[model samples]
Target chain A: MDLSFVIFVEVLYGVASLVLISAGLAVVFGMMKVINLAHGEFMMMGGYATITAVGYGVNVFVAMLIIAPLVVGLIGLVVERLVIRHLYGRLIDTMLATWGLSLVFIGLATMIFGNTTTGISTPIPGFAFGGYQVNGYNFFIIIVSILLVITMYAILRGTRAGLIARGTMQHSDMASALGYSSDRIYMMTFFCGSALSGLAGAVLAPLVGLVPTSGGAYIAKAFITVIAGGPSLIAGLVSSATSFGLVSQFFTFTISPVIGEVALLIAAVILLRTMPKGITGRFFKGKL
Target chain B: MSRRASQDVTITLVVSAFLIWFLPLMISTYTLTVLVIYGMLGLSLGLIWGFGGILCFGQAAFFGLGAYTYAITAINIGESTLPMILAVLVPAVFAALLGAMMFYGRLTDVYLGVITLVVTLILFKFMNSTAGPQYAIGNARLGGFNGIPGFQTLNVPGDPSAYIWGDTYFYVCALALVIVFLLVTWLLRSSFGRIAVGIRENEVRMGLMGYNVAARKTMLFAIGAAIAGLAGALFANWGEIVTPNLFSLGQSAEIIIWCIVGGLGTRFGPIVGAAGLAYLKFMLGQQSMIDNTLIMGLILVLFVLFLPRGLVPAIETLLNSIIGHKKRKPKPHRMRRARHG
Candidate 1:
């Protein structure tokens, strides 16, 4: 393959990854007021689960299917009940508490797994599509992310649960007064957000090798995306992620990755200042 | 005069001065050095969070910036003291600029925290990645994963004293600590300090009173950054190494934890917090087999939930209770009966 062609393929993959992860985060943030600082940690947990499953002589794809989201979701539920539940309405306390929780989780993971990078075996060995040599595992991730997005959007907009969740987001007290169980909705939303983060981790584990500290890398970028896209708009987050990914990739190819990340962040900050409510906010200003 | 109401300001000053003068002789060099460094960091956080009510989670950015500035400039200039000054100045200026932008933009407390965090993270990533050939700075290589080393030591010109090591250096550090602490205390007691308190209490009221709340906040942030930068410079000179880890979220969280654990609004709370936590971590490190962080996390959770007022206030209340106070004199019986009727 030519050099330019390879770059194009790489850029496409980057854009796809950012969009998938950002969309998942947006859904969670929109529904639940909690900004999960340990979101990336959930992804890390999922990655570890995938690797562990593979190590146990399980079929890579099957192991990821069973282990990734389930383990991540379970951990998320526990975190919600034990720690995150105490953090609602209080932003600073929540941020500090979750940050400390992240550190503890990281320390535990480091102790158990040791400080080394581990890679999972590709789920579909020798899988290829046309001249583009697709990793069947990554393709599966993309498909799953797309399906998840579709399902989340449908559930958010078309179902009773979706309406209740939206009502809670708009006005928590009013939702409760209307006889809907806000607590249950909150729990479900937290579970779904964490599960999506886990799914991202499980799917990306094979693509990006797993390390104990790897989760820290994605967190700042995810935060930027969420803020720039406006935490309330899923479509805005998806678009922002795609744009950021493309910009990052283009800059990485032309200048350097480090410079690219810096540029993206600077741009994101500037954009945030200019458009505090994000693209969707700008477009739907009158109605929203 | 009421005995409890008597001012002991002179005695307090004399005692503090004596401690400042004699701390090196009283403690081991290691202990003295750690206390000085941690105390300085604690003061910085206290100024920012306690006075300004800005819960910054990324003072480590300024800390790392100061260290790097000192290290790089020292290497280039072939002198320690000048570079150290430059180090503190650079981070302070950077912080001032960032603060101005954030404050003027009208970002609230939470957004301010997020912006600082994002900036620090970006700096961390940039430094972490640019350690290779493309970003090398002379023989002091950025070294990506390895970090910069062999930083110059602070020097005093022509005193025939030579550069001190161990206890002597600890004495110098303690002296610096005393000076900075006094300066901070004075600042906090000044008119500007009262305005800062007013800003914290009701910024809208302060604004309506024409206090320029944003400018005050920005200035306070800059002052805090300068102090943090000073600590960073001292740390680099003491440790003789600078790394991207200094800018990490872990370091920032540690600073916030120190401030929270000590006492929020009290003068010595951060000092106590930093020293106590550092001592605990050091002791835990010695144990080797135990998971120290788990214990620390539990303590933090307990403190946040139960002892939210922090250790200093709790201690003060306990002391006040133990001292035994006189009961108030009863009101006139006739007046009391009339009031009741």
Candidate 2:
């Protein structure tokens, strides 16, 4: 394959991954008010679970499908119940509390897994696609992410639970008063968000090595995505993620990744300051 | 201040200072050096969080920045003291600029915390990468992961002294700590400090009252950065090395943990917190039996959940209770009487 084609493929992969992560973040933020700083930790948990399952002689694909989200979701539920549930509405408390929780989680992971980066065996053996030379495992992630996004979109737009979740996001007290249990919505939202993060982790495990501190790398980017996309709209998240990914990749190819990230962050900060409500607000101001 | 409160404050200061001065004499050089570093770290955290109410998790960024700056500048200038000053000044100015940008953008509290964290993480990554053009001061190239070493030593005022081998150096560190502590305390008691406190309590009200809340926060933050920079410069001199770990998230989190553990919003809480935690960590390291971090995490959880007000306030309350002093009570029905009148 040509150099330009390789760069194009890389950029596509980057954009796809960004979209998946940002969509997950949007869903979580739209439903639950929690910032979930440990969201990346959930991803790490999933990645670890995938690696562990592979080690246990399980079919890599099947193991990832079942183990990744399940382990991550379960951890997410426990975290919500134990720590995050108490931190609702209190911003500083939530940030600090989650930060402490992140530390504990990182420490525990390091103790259990040691400081080494763990690898996951690729699922589809030597499967490859086109002149782009795509790895089967990463291809699977891209496909699964697309499927998840579609499924989430359907559930959110079509279901009664989704309505209630959206209502809770709009106003917790009012939602409770109107007989929609905000606590239950919050729990469901937290679980789903965590599950998605885990799924992302599991899917990406084959593509990326899992280190104890890997989660810290993605967190800042995830936050920037959320802010840039605007927390309120799903489509806005999709657009923001794709654009950011493309921009970052383009910059990374031409210049440097570090410079790209800094540029992206500076742009995001400027955008956020100028448009606090985000791009979605321009059009959907009345409805949202 | 009340007579008893003043007396109690005086007693606490004298006792603590005496203990610190005597500690090095009794302990090993390594232990003494560690304690001094902890004291410096605590002073940094105290100035920022306690006075400004800015829960900065990125102090280690400045600390590390100062260390690298000092090391590099010292190598270039061929003088230890001037480089040390440059180290502190560079980071302080960087922090001041960053602070102005953040505060002026109206990012307060959590947002402020996130931006600082992101900045530190970027620095960490940038330093760790080592792929880009190397930053060179004279012939000294920042070796990235390997860090800068064999930099200039601390210059004592009177006698020509060899670097890194004496009780005298530690004594100088002690003196530096005292000066920093007094300087911070004085700053806290000034009008600027009062304005910072007002901003912390009710920034909106302060702004409405014509106080420039952003400027105040920026100034306080810069002061805190300067202190951390000073600590970092001293640290490079003591450790004789500088690494990217200074800019790591772990370092930042550790400082925040120290502040939280010591007691936020109190003058000496950070000192107590940093010293107590550092000593415990040292003991744990010496034993080599337990995971020090796991224990630290547990303590953090316990403190946040149970002792949210932290150790200093808890101690103060306990002391007050032990003294058998009746707590002053507000006059009952005052609101109702005022309404009736």
The local distance difference test score of each candidate is 0.74, 0.73
lDDT (C-alpha) at residue A71 in model 2: 84
Cα lDDT, model 2, residue B161? 53
Where does candidate 1 chain B have its weakest 10-residue lDDT segment?
Answer: B332-341
Q: Cα lDDT of model 2 overall?
A: 0.73
lDDT for each residue of candidate 1 in B183-203, tens digit (9 for 90 to 100): 777787778987987777777
Q: Could you give candidate 2's per-residue lDDT for residues A1-288 as a string of tens digits?
A: 566766776776777787666554566665664666677777778889888988888888776778888888888888888877876765555555666777677777888898898886675754444555655555565677678767877777789987777778878999999988788888888888888888877787777789877877677777777756655556666666777778878778789887777666666656656655555555444333
DockQ (model 1, Cα) = 0.26
Model 2 CA deviation exceeding 4 Å by range = A1-5, A22-28, A125-137, A272-288, B1-13, B131-134, B157-165, B286-290, B326-341
**TM, every model:** 0.89, 0.90
Candidate 1, superposed: residue stretches over 4 Å from native? A1-9, A23-25, A125-138, A285-288, B1-27, B132-141, B158-161, B321-341
